[model samples]
Target: MSDNVYIAVHGGAGFHERKYEKEIKHALQRACNVALSNLGSKHSSALTMVEDAISSLEDDEHLNAGYGSNLTLDGTVECDAAIMSGKSGCFGSVGAVAGVKNPIRLARAVLDHSSIPSPIGRIPPLTLVSEGARQFALSQPSSAHLVSRESLVSPQAEERWRVWKCRFASSDPSSLSGNLNDIQDTVGAVAWHESDGMAAGVSSGGLLLKYPGRIGEAAVFGAGCWAQEASDVEQGMEMACSISGTGEYIIRAMLARRLGEAFEKGAGNSDGDDPHEVLHGVLNDQFWNMRRGRGEPDPSVGVLLLTRENDGRARLWCAFTTPTMAIAYVSSKNPKAKAIILRRPQNITLGDDKPCIYITGISL
Candidate 1:
């Protein structure tokens, strides 16, 4: 009812349970708000909002990105990120670039335009490749690779973090799935708005293992991120190139393309079957009903809903994995309810009688 578009975002679904102070929660939430508000104010472009949100989050050391990122099982930090724009049918991305504070912003820089400037071949981005080789060539203990090699010199204190030992079972066959550490710790964001179309971005600290090539869906075209004008496909919609990972890519694709279509239909009805309600309906019900073939369940997924309707209105909503799964053991677990926020947004409040279409009804 506030006419604010919808957007949703998340770091990772599979997280560890850790308690932080209210101030910490407020700090991160405020950070989220700042990113959203800044992008929303500047251009109102969905692409801009998602990309900048990622940039802001990546800048924060508390998050599992950029600086302070968890060392891969190989004792190094390798990052991946991507962004897609719906209206233009174009996107940009980057994979495994270290020393760069915010990998998502870099990916955003690539997505905002065309012809991502080719690197001079095998620079910092190739660190992952180099590290993985060292891990294997050295035959380093898998357990040693799982935790950071940083040495703490507090004479009276012990280490603060812990890594599992059995995590290195040779019998456990899943070669490429070597990233037992980072596979679950992830960050994903998508946004849609009025005056524009839809767009999304995903950034992750990849899983660790020997020979861990930079395989971020963010860098792969049309996998993790994608966009296209809902108003016209003939005009061609923009899409983010995503890497191969059936579950992750498909989920966002439907949210961007299909959800966009559903929102358009629901918004046209005078009864106020708004975008959120329509999206919720399709995801909670129809989408699953239509799911086909056998595929690994993508339980570690999150949403950022920010988009506008044909009537020139906007809204924001969010959903994520169950708390058991949403806990970012290595990162942060500050979230609302199971899928709803525990505290109401200070600046954002749903209008009365305008109902959420699911909880309440629309007005004339």
Candidate 2:
């Protein structure tokens, strides 16, 4: 296999200016760099690349995943995460798992250990929750036990939790408003490795002040993440997808799998239509429009796509419904990299002039 690799990441999907723009951009760039830098190493695969990528964002206090995850209504933090490999059709996820410093890492461990033998009569569960997941992690021969819940909570997170808890007691509905800009702040990554395999992973602290046991779209397979390995690359299509945004809406829309199916349908067309237009149309015309028409809260959505064509070049696409989507990308063909907070673009048609979903991407 060649050493070619590519990666992209988002801090979250909603209104997030908790830190200055420079700081946020730096975080995105740093995360992308961590993933892209491993492209040169022979040992790096798409699975490991994405795991490393999300770990960077999780460690940063500005993002809302591992160390800086949001608190539940009861002022406790419970995180959710999942990882899937396209080639093996294997997956692992953890939901409402607490006290772990990096949930994605635990998800990866589940994927790695799911098939291993336990004590004679025991069978390791593929997906784990709450205390079970934490205890499982400690039992494994991993480097360290799960971190204390206090060690994972940031000061900002603590303050936000306190305020929200007070509003909850007073029955103040005003504090429940979703910050559209920062709502898409959950992090994810999709990658295509030189070995001709695809993989994707997502991690998020559920919505602000959500119910204690809430498990968002991120922990659900084919909802927040999906990937399928190709048996014959020349004659068939291979796809991987990841979504960030309002978990409820994402679950309702079946965002990731639906998008992947559309790509598959595009491949069956003789004319070879680009999947980008199809993705944009679905989001603008079907998903976002329907939500707004129904008077539902339009939590912003961000999508990352990695697809492989028979020609051997990898196509990358990213789109978001928010005013701006923070992103960074790097590929072997282009070693130089940069991160940008891309603004949503509007298009004017003959009969209508409304904003269309903007997809900024590259083919490498």
Candidate 3:
């Protein structure tokens, strides 16, 4: 199969410049690189990026997500995640999975195997079954396997592993000791894998205090992530990207999605499928503040744009934020630059209209 282009994203949303220490920034960068490396070796599928990002969030204790996800009034870390495809429009999602690192990937698997995709015309797409889907998850390498819920006990290194398994494996929640209220964070990933082997994926993790009620877009399809024609997303009747930013972070990330929609509509349809050129127009486009929120200054979103091609093209774009600063990364056809790096957007524009990702119907 030809190596086609594919891209995915995980938006952290708003960030505070002073909040992230050098170590923190470096850690985030390393996670991005790890995500790509995992994908390249096929050790981790496109969906694995979702797990990679959330794992970092848990380790960092930032962005009100992952292990650090915000706490509810009662204090608990109930989480949610969603994954979708820009290609087949298939989506899968799960909410409140405790002890699981990559909720988004599981959701993507649901979409990949369970749902019946919308008809693509005279030709109809076959659907996947749950049994096969379960096998797919089991097939991953140890690094990609669903780490047992016991992995996060926060105990001495010698006994941490055994303790975690003991706590999480129990049939009764009562058996688990320390703070049963708050769990870890929620995670999700999106990707498009073609019959020819091209694919894309995205992920996000949020929530800290083990709060149960705070549900963000990452747990829902079309709201957080999307993709197309690559593999399984086409059935949803819409292809879109994933959302990793928090409530505030999500609102800010809108700017980037606005740009993507513009590209889809024709902001920069040059002679070829050069995504780099597409970014030139998408990132630079100017727009007014959109979707009024409770806060002033009208918020928006950022992006990490990626593109690739052997014969066909695949793109992965990630957007994230915190109170300190926003981060974006891109990966694509250029094998030399498989690593994800931060970018300074020269023209950060806000949209007055609410940030939205539109999924075209199969009929369209």
**TM-score of candidate 3 against the unseen true structure:** 0.52
Evaluate residue 241 in candidate 2 and report its C-alpha lDDT on the 0 to 100 scale: 76
Task: Give Cα distance to truth, residue 91, candidate 1, Å.
Answer: 0.8
TM-scores of the candidates in the order shown:
0.56, 0.87, 0.52
lDDT of 2 by residue, 27-106 (tens): 87888788877665667888888888888888987778888788887777788888888887778888998898889888
Name the 10 consecutive residues with the lowest summed lDDT in model 3. Answer: 355-364
Clashes of each: 55, 16, 92
lDDT top scorer? 2
- The regions of model 1 sitting more than 4 angstroms off are 1-8, 16-18, 21-24, 36-46, 113-162, 169-185, 188-198, 208-211, 232-298, 324-364
Better of 2 and 3 by lDDT: 2
lDDT of 1 by residue, 153-238 (tens): 11111111113223444444453332343333355555555556666777665543323345544455544555554353222122
